[model samples]
Target: MSGKGDCYDNAVMESFFGTLKNEWVHHQQYQSRYQARSDIFKYIEGFYNTVRLHSSLGYMSPNEFEAKYHDNP
Candidate 1:
């Protein structure tokens, strides 16, 4: 956990949301709340975690990183 008023504590989450907005939310238009929710869920599960390459993770997607970690461990 991060201390009070510490940006570092929330840096990871902030980065995630920034990416989500930039790569997904900013490009889409939703007809209803349900549509927005469903689309965002799909984006996170189908693309962000599986396909998006993250620089901090050595240019690997989250799924790839986890798979490699478990395979080696």
Candidate 2:
């Protein structure tokens, strides 16, 4: 289990949620909680992790960076 109650401990999680809400969640209207859940899952897993270009990863898609790292390592 992880330790609790430090600002830095949750920095990454907070940033991720902030981005999710700002970029995706706040833009959508769902008819039910299940629809919101499905959409958020798809947005994060299907699009954000696989296809979105992350600035921190040198503007490359996460999948591209991960493949390069494993190939070169």
Task: Please provide TM-scores, in order, for all candidate models, with all chains considered together.
Answer: 0.76, 0.82
Instruction: List all candidate RMSDs to the true structure.
Output: 2.4, 2.6
> Can you write out model 2's per-residue Cα lDDT over 1-73, one digit (the tens) per residue?
3578776778888999999999999999999999999999999999999988989999999999999999999
Instruction: List the candidate 2 regions with Cα displacement exceeding 4 Å.
Output: 1-6
User: For each candidate, what is the lDDT?
Assistant: 0.92, 0.94
Segments in model 1 whose C-alpha atoms lie over 4 Å from true places = 1-9
> Model 1 clash pairs?
none
lDDT, residue 14, model 2: 93
Q: Candidate 1 vs. truth: CA RMSD?
A: 2.4
